[model samples]
Target: MNKYKLYSSTDFLNDDSFVEWLLKSDHDAEMFWDTFVEEHPEKKNEIEEAVEIYNHFKFTSEDLTLEEVFAIWNNVKHKSVEKRFSFLTVLKYAAVFVLVFTTGALSYYLYNNATEETEFTIAENKPLNFNEAQIILSDGKSVPLNSKESEIKYDATGEQVIIDNDTIRQAKKEAEPTINRVVIPYGKSSQVTLSDGTQVWLNAGSQLVYPSVFKERQREVLLIGEAYFNVAHNAKVPFVVRTEHADIEVLGTSFDVLAYPDDKMFQTILVTGSVSIETKSKGLLSGKNKMVLEPNQMFYLDKESGVNYVNNVDVATYTSWKEGMFDCDKLDLSRVVRRLERYYNKQIHIKDPLIGTYKISGKLDLKGDISEVLDVIQSFVPIDWGKQQNGDYFIVKPY
Candidate 1:
């Protein structure tokens, strides 16, 4: 018999009837059984029991002879049963085996295969961690704040208080303009009180450019990534937030803007007060393309189509980050990853394309470590996470 035949035949050793038939057969059959038992000493008892049952089946049933059983065993072992018997005849033999074994061996085999360990490789591309906050003076110089020897200076402009603690001195200007940019790099965030008494929360990997002070007409600030603003009500001066895709203008209201250059859509959500959004042409804001937004309304602009849509949503989900939590409702995996990247300061890659379309709804404690967030998500998906050569953590599908 071929060695492969013996290996395959071992699968049937647990079947009692097959063992009995093999034991009553000729010397060649007995030699095969002995060799199998010698090769698998761990299954010696099971092999002996199977052989006893085969002998019983051959002798107890007068219809079956030793020669007939041996021929059937040889036919099955060589896979030549098709030449000797029709499909119906083979089915009858199979029915006898099923009656004796009850498919116990096959069931166990399938169970083992189903429980086998599968490994998935997740790409390591996590979010960026902006840890340093700095202010760019009107003279094009960057001054790092949060330093130890910084003195806090107080500058009062109307009702707004400017804390110029040496590390960040407010650029003093009187109307003749210059563009002063405040950069919040990776791994850092900063809070700025604009000249209009509006409070601005700048997230990591973002930059805000504004004049030294607000002019007489409008309060304007250019944003790169994401920010939440609580505008001071000055009915006369409309506060304008400028991003690559759209411009948001409000009289005095609280709102959030998500305008990452890599994002496919620019979103603005109003919590309190009213605002107007203007989509830029060729990525530049100008003219009559402005759309107004009321309280509790969100303005969404498709980055590619240049089309704007308005909808109502639970505002808390958008503003939860400021409160140290991430609350999402039915958001896609890609959108969730984007938020994670901004919060953790690392890049993330989803190796499994199917994961991108997976929709999730949950609240995460933003104050917790990034790994905790990943673990929470892993509960629903089969993901493998690891670091890359560039030191970013990426998530991928498991095999």
Candidate 2:
């Protein structure tokens, strides 16, 4: 059924799926809307008005933030209401607004974007100092989680944070959503339920920055390591996961993103629905600046060469870490070792680079000790491993 049969032009404009249809970003959205218009012929007028309103504005991140665009939009809407004019009628008088806001905002963005980006870059380079998992609130308060796999949930209002058995209330002094961060150290993982009810499984050695509540315009989160997101459905406000290399946008979907700053590659595996990835082109080998992925597909970006590509993949292999299991499907030995290092909080040095290139596949219970997991891997491959004097494990080719 067409869920948006009763949506007004304004509602359609706010809908992420509708915008996706308009932008032709997802084939599923295009198909669904085509069927919707066919079934609800009477909605043609509303749809046309929405299309017109949407097409009239050409705002990008380079020009203005979503808040600024919304402010200008509200001004136009107010004029329409005061004059008792149609949406299009008010747009006729919005030329000056469009020009002035666009030009001024673009100039301001150009002036400050570099500094803003530099600040974040500097922060990203800093080392993680916390020994345990913790949640840092906007009020500069830090709530520590001692559990190895802690569960942190927020109420829809974003003011109440439920960490395990305790509920902590935050003061909401302003209309804007308060920013919060979840930091997970090595050998620890956490699950976070955002204010919007989106479930995020934060893996070991990860950090997630999100609002206590989502804004009307969008729901966005910044991820420093890896996380699996089961985004809540909010057609009116798209959910976006921002990483160092790419911005992934989805109306509602389940996906796993691996973008550890130190890792050589960035990856996104879609479990269901659709997502669009806009890669930040920092180097020459970036294949495409923008792409859309379907379910069961993976988007991979090689940071070293600035190359990215999409391919079909078994979603389970990438997302299983969240489920207390590590499913390896013919993956490289070095890649598997890196994940183990994070999971177990122990350094495993591959003494022979040739041993790291060997492909191995298996499902190992991550709950067991690191040695037990390594024994399982050794059973499947010809490798010898032992602990070093420095208390780290070393893998070598068997004599």
Candidate 3:
């Protein structure tokens, strides 16, 4: 199947067809599994190990209540035909167990196992590049923001004010809500506070279009690129973030959204509270569907395939960019470089494409010079860089 390949052990373990075959001996699933087994017999060991992992973390082991366990088992019994039960079938049921529970919301959650020893293909292209940060105030006056420290703050009375030291930035005449747009260019970041007390850390190359004050029942904002938001809780008012790829609705949550338009994917990582994400992609059975995310879970939507997958991740790894640090655990070199390109507003071409497959662990501070970061990277990996006449960088295997 063009749609099928090994994303990770977690992918297959949480696959629908695989789970169907496990629980119900579904006809199509049986065919796929039979063909898969015939083709890649070597992965049988891995498949078995994934099954063991599922069983170990079953509802009984997790925080699921006894009623949940009993309800799921009842469904399992109905799914299983009157035919004799096999040990393999039982294993399948356990391996794909996470799919059984779905939130009542119109969203879907695809979970992953984090323990796979797999090298994933990473996107390296960066096309949403820009040069400067700006604030478009209500009077149509554009105030330039510096890369060092650019910030904005507004209040419920619809007042706008810039927060860079030694700067005179103010807005007057606010009897109603007014839209304010803040654009943060690549190589820089910013911070903003909405009138509702919601705080947002705008990442490099991001644009946030928000209202100067909250109105009525909802607080909505439009985002491009990436941002981390700690929404102020108001039970009567909901906070929503709209991206090109998805719409995230929340009551109150701390979450990070990475929706760089040029990248091959859109990603969201939930740090705390809950969120319901609605994709513009129309659904088959539901007409339109949404995907709900729990804390510490990350979702990546492949732009080309329109297929999104979720996995467990260290929340800090994705959210740390706002803190001027890049935290990764065995992340692909190409992906790391892509992020650096955005943060530095520089282009880096890897002379040896194979080096992109290399993975690095740990964290690096992004507040330093680009050359300094490269030096640290080279110290860890056998790589070096040369600057081109055009000011772009070329990374190569050191002499």
Candidate 4:
């Protein structure tokens, strides 16, 4: 049996001060509480009681005198003795008893204070920072669709490319023009709505080099990182996404590509429609090596061996981020932290290596508060997190 620590009334009072520190400081106090509860289950009841008192104090401006505070403490002590519950009593009962009394006092205060104005101000809105990729023309000039710009018509091609409100728009033209190579920097993502109205969502630290317009023969795009594509159907013009090791050709489909340069494998998950992937380096373009995928199928290419494998998976798990949710299906801690880093734009350091291997499966709404999301994750994982000097989080596997 694990030896549990018992928190006395004094300890409960000290915890009130800790709650104040938790709210004022930038650290993730809820994560701390989660780990603390796991380690000291015996004190969980006392800690919850302290939390109720702290919250009650926070909502009221009337400060209790030291004498009044002592009196209240004595009242609580007397009730504990009168109840004469066993020391091994369940934590939930104690928490409920403490909360009931605290809530009674809070209700009385709120009812008597008629002049106290309680207005809720909406929290400050933080706009989503989208990463964008740009196409740098062959000339010294660059076409930056992610930046604000006025519409300009190309004198040579007569094709209209509008850069406004930090978005790039390409108007359909009679003739498709050739485009030069472009690079996408890290921490940025850009979208290209194809001539057929297909949308592509690019991930951060990735690049796609393509022409200004596609030719009649074939529409080809070079991918370096991760991107999601809703390909336009044109039997005459096949849509081909080319990476370093393999090429994915599709007639009309929606799929996600994960081919980060540093990663060991390139993954292509088909959400809808069908796609054929071919490997040029392995000289395995033969029917035996070529892999075809249907909806809900994922194809992975090993970087070292140039071998491809296909598996069935849940399509929503890969596409959830586009819909403003974090969906993880048995994902390891490292992968979870990686997605969090991108979403929050913060660096994370895991103090314990073993923690990275812990698998997690859940879907968290990105539209909610970050702390709420963190609290939900803490409920499932055995770890503690706190803010670092640079406003990032330091995650540690608790003993």
> Model 1 TM-score?
0.60
Give the root-mean-square deviation of each candidate in angstroms. 31.6, 16.2, 18.9, 28.3
C-alpha local distance difference test of each model: 0.63, 0.79, 0.72, 0.61
Where does candidate 3 stray beyond 4 Å? Answer: 1-130, 165-177, 282-287
Q: Candidate 2, TM-score vs. the true structure? A: 0.68
Q: Output the TM-score of candidate 3.
A: 0.65
Q: Per-residue lDDT tens digits of candidate 3, residues 1-399?
A: 544455356776778766556655657877877787678776676667766776675332112322354346544544564565563566477544433322111111111123422111111122112466877665545567864647677655665464674333445544534556677888889999888888999998888876666667657887889999999988787788877667888899999999887787889899999988887643231133488999999988885556888899999999998889999889988999999998998999998998888888888899889998888888778888879999998888778
Judge candidate 1 against the unseen true structure and give its global Cα lDDT, from 0 to 1: 0.63
Per-model TM-score, in order, reads: 0.60, 0.68, 0.65, 0.57
Best by lDDT: 2
Q: Which residue pairs of candidate 2 clash?
A: none
lDDT of 3 at 392: 98
After the best TM-score superposition of candidate 3, give how far the Cα of residue 86 lies from its true spot, in angstroms: 73
Q: For model 4, how does the per-residue alpha-carbon lDDT over 321-397 read when each residue is reduced to its tens digit?
A: 66667789999988888767655556777888898998999897865655666677778899887788888777787
For residues 1-399, could you state the per-residue lDDT of candidate 1 as single tens digits? 243244333456655544544534557767766786777776676555554554464322122322243334533544442366454564577655433222111000001112442111111122112355665455444456563112222233422223444334544445435445556765556677766567787776777766555667647777888888998899887787867667788888899998876677889999988888877554122223778777778888876656778999988888887766889888888888888887777888887778888887878886777888888888866677777899787888876
Task: Give a tens-digit lDDT track for model 2, residues 1-399.
Answer: 556878888989888777767765467877777788898989888999999997787543232333364456545544544655465664577675554333311110111212222111111112234567888776656778989999999998888999998999988757434777788999999999998899999999998888788767767788889999999988888888887778898999999999887788899999998999988755222233889999999999987666788999999999999989999999899999999999988999999998999998889899989999999999989999999999999999888
